[model samples]
Target: MVLDLLVVNPNSSRSMSDEIARSVAAVDAFRAFAFKTTYMTGPEGAPPQIDGEETSHQSCDACLPLLKDPESEYFYKRYDGILIGCFSDHPLVEALTCLTDAPPVVGLLNSSLSFVSLFPSGPSSVITSNKEWVEILDASVEKKFLTGEARARGLWKGTVSSNLQVLELHSEENFGKIVERIRRENVERLGSKYVILGCAGFSGLQYKLKKIFPEVIFVDPIILGFQTLLSSATFLKCQNV
Candidate 1:
C-alpha cells in the first residue's frame, strides 16, 4: 500500500513549500510513498513570530481552511501523517493537531533537535532567520527536549543564535558571504560541533556551509522533517498490518 504524507507549510509562502517538496523528493525512502506538499494562504509572507509556539499555533490556525478545503481532497483523505514545515513547534503544532484529524503531527523544530541528539555532541547551535527568534527557539528547546536525564547528562550542548537577516541575504552574491560570516562568528567562535539551520531559507545553504566547514555537522530542517515523515509512515504501516 502507498502511504500518503502531506507536508504543510503553515505560513503563506508557496516558494518555501516548493523548496521543501523538492528536498523531500530527493529522499529515496519517499519513493514508495505518495507525498503531497501544500501551502497556507492566510498571511502573504512569513509570519513574524514563527519562532514562538503561540504565534506558530496561530499561524497554523489561520492556515487550516486551506488544508480542509475540498480542493485538497487527497491531502485530507489519503494522508496518513502531516508534517508542519515551520521551524517552531510550539503553539502552532499544538493548535494544528487539536483542530485537525491529522495524527502524528511533526514539526521541523522538534525533528531537527531530536536529530541533533543522535550526534556526538560537543556543542550544537540553531541558526535562525533573525535575532528576534532566538528567545523563542531557546524556550522551545528547554520546554520540549531539555528535561530529565537528558539535561543532566549534558548530551545537548551550546547556545542558540540568529543570523539577523536570513531572508534578505538569499541573493547569490550575499548568501555565501553571510553564511561564512555566521560560521565564523557563531559556530567557530563558540566552538560548536553541529549547527542546525533553523529556517527553510537556510536549507538552501547547507551545501555551501558543509564545504566551508567540512568537519562541522549542519542539520537541515527540511531534510530532518522529511526523514521524520518517512520514518513515521513506515512505522504506521507496520502497525496497520
Candidate 2:
C-alpha cells in the first residue's frame, strides 16, 4: 500500500523543482500515507517561468523529452501517478496521461481550482505573481473547472495586483511588501476569504502567510496537485482490486 509519486516541474530551474518537492514532502499527509515522492525539472531549454501561451508551449515541448529520459521513464513505469507542477495546466499533462493507461496525470491549475471550490465560502480570489497571468489563469479557471454545458462560472471573485515575476517570487527584493499588499488588497479590501497561489514558484508560501493572516485561507496549487495525484492513484488502485 505504498504510494510513489513524481512531480515534474515544467521549468529549467532545479531550484523551483526543489521548492515544490520540499513543500509537498513537509506535509503530514506524506508521512501518514507512506509516500515516496520524486521530482524532476524540465528540459534545459524551458523557461524559468511560463508567463503566457508561448512559454507554456515551450515548457510542454521541453517536458516531453525529459519524461522520456531513462530516469524519468523508470518513474513513469513504477510511480502511482505523475503531477505536473506548473500552475499553467501545461499540455504535458495530456501528453503524460496518454503515455499510460493506469497512472493518471494531474495538473496544479486544475486541482487547485477544484480544491478552491470545496471551501464553503463565496468571493475567493487568486493571487498570482505576474499581471500577464491574470487573464490566462482566469480563462483556465472558467474553461477547465467551471464550465458546464454552454455556460461558464468562474470561482475566483478577483485577482490581486501583484506585479512581481513568477521566478522572483521566493527571492524578490520587495517580497514582504508585495505580500502585505496582496493581503491588504485581496483579503481586506476585496472581501476574498481564500486566495489561490497562481504560480508554482509560490510553493511553501502558505506556511509563512498563514502565520500572519490566520483568518485568510491561502491555497498552494502544488500541494493540492500532489494530494490530488495521490488520491487519484489510490482510487485507481482500489478499482483494480
Candidate 3:
C-alpha cells in the first residue's frame, strides 16, 4: 500500500507554492516509500506572505478552520503524514498534534531543531529571509527548544537573516546576498557547521550553498520535514503488523 502526504504552504502566495513544488521535485528522498503527495496553498482568507507574528496568526486563522472543520475533506481523510511548510512555530502544529488524532505532522522549525538536537552536530544555526524573523524565530527557539535538559548541549547558536523578502529570493542578486550572509555571519564569525534554511521559500538552495560552503552542512527545512514525516510514518506502520 502506498502512503499519502499533504504538504501545506500555510500562506496564499501562488509563486511561493510553485517554488516549493519545484524544490520538492528536486529531491530523491520520496523514493524511499511508495507515496502519493498533494500540495495545497492557503485558501482565500490566508495571507499572501507570512512576514511577522501578525501575518503568521492570519495564515493560521485562515488554515486551521479548514483543517479541523467536520464538513471539510481534510478532517476525515487520514494521510500517512503531513508537512507544514512554515519555518516559524505556527500554532497549527500545536492544534493538530494535541487537539486531533492527526498522523505524524512535521513543522519545518521543529523538525530541523529536533534533528540537530538528536545528532548534536557541532554548532548549528538557521538562516531566515527578513529582519523580523531573526527575533521571532530566536524567541520561539529559546522558548521551546532551548530549555530544560536540552540547554546543556547548546546545539543552536542563533538565527540569522538576509534582510530580503520571500519573492526576492528568486533573483540572482538576492541569492548572492544569501551566500555572503552565510559566509560572513554563519561561517567566519559564528563558526557554524550546520545551518538550517529557515524559510519555506529556500527550497532549492542546498546544492548552490554546498558549492561555496563545501565543508559546512546546510539543512533545507522542507526536505528535512518531509524525511522526518516519512520516517515516522514508516515506523508507526511497522508497529501495527
Candidate 4:
C-alpha cells in the first residue's frame, strides 16, 4: 500500500517546498515505506520565511484558504495525511484539524518533540534562526506539553540560534556554511547530542550535518512530521483490514 502525503510549506517560496520534498525523499523510512508526496507553497503574499509569532500568524492566515481551495481540491480530497512544514506548531495545524473530513495534520515541531521523547538518552537541543525565535518556540513547547516537562524529561535541553535571518538559510550562498558552523558549535560546545532542526528553512541540512558531525543525531522536523503522518495513516489502514 502506498501512502499519499501532502506537505504544505506555509511560505511563498517554492524553494522551501522543494527542499522539504528533497529532505523527506532522502529519508530511509520513506524509501522503505513506499509513499508518494506532493509539495505546495503557501498562497501569494505569505512571508518568505516564518521567524517569530507574527510571521507564523501570517503564514497560517495565508495557508488556510489554499487547504480548502476549490481549485486545489486534491488538498482536501486526495491525501491520506498532511504535513505542515514549519518548525513551530503553527496555528495551521490546529485549524486544519477542525475542517470536515480533514486528514491528520502533522506539525513539525509537535512531531519532532514527540519523537525525541521516545529516546531520552541525552541532552536534546534545537537550532533555529535568529534570537527572537527563542521565546516563540520555547512557549510552543510549554503550551503543547506543559511547563518543565520538556526539560525535566531531557526532551529539550535548550535552543541555540544560527544568528541568520530565516529566509537566508535557504539561499544557496548561505545554506551550507551557515548550518555547518552553527551545528558545529551546538555539538562541540553546547553539548547537544540530539539536535532538532528548529527551522523548516533548514529542511535539507540534516544530510550534510550528519556527514560532518557523525556523532550527533540531527532531527529535522519536516522529516519527522512526514514519518509521523505516514506511520499513523498506515496503522489506521491496517485496523480497517
> How well is each residue in 1-241 modelled by candidate 2, as lDDT tens digits?
9898878999999999999998777554443455678877876989877888899899888778767565765356677888888887688888777775537888887787677667654557888877888788778766676534213343467566478887778885767966787778888787777888877888888888888888888899888888888887766665555
RMSD of 1: 12.0
Assess the local accuracy of residue 205 in candidate 4 as a C-alpha lDDT between 0 and 100: 83
The lDDT of each candidate is 0.68, 0.76, 0.83, 0.78
lDDT tens string, model 3, 78-189?
Answer: 5777788999998778878876567888899988888777656588888898899999999999988664444677656898898898768768878889999999998877
Best by lDDT: 3
Candidate 1 residue-wise lDDT, 121-213, digit = tens: 466777777666787777778987654544666645544444545456466776666666566755667666778887776777788788878
Estimated TM-score per prediction?
0.72, 0.76, 0.81, 0.76
| Candidate 2: Cα lDDT at 79 | 76
Q: By TM-score, how accurate is candidate 1?
A: 0.72
Ranking by lDDT: 3, 4, 2, 1
List clashing residue pairs in candidate 3: none
Candidate 1 lDDT (Cα, 0 to 1): 0.68
How far does residue 188 in candidate 1 sit from its true spot (Å)?
2.7
Q: What 10-residue stretch in candidate 2 is worst by lDDT? A: 146-155
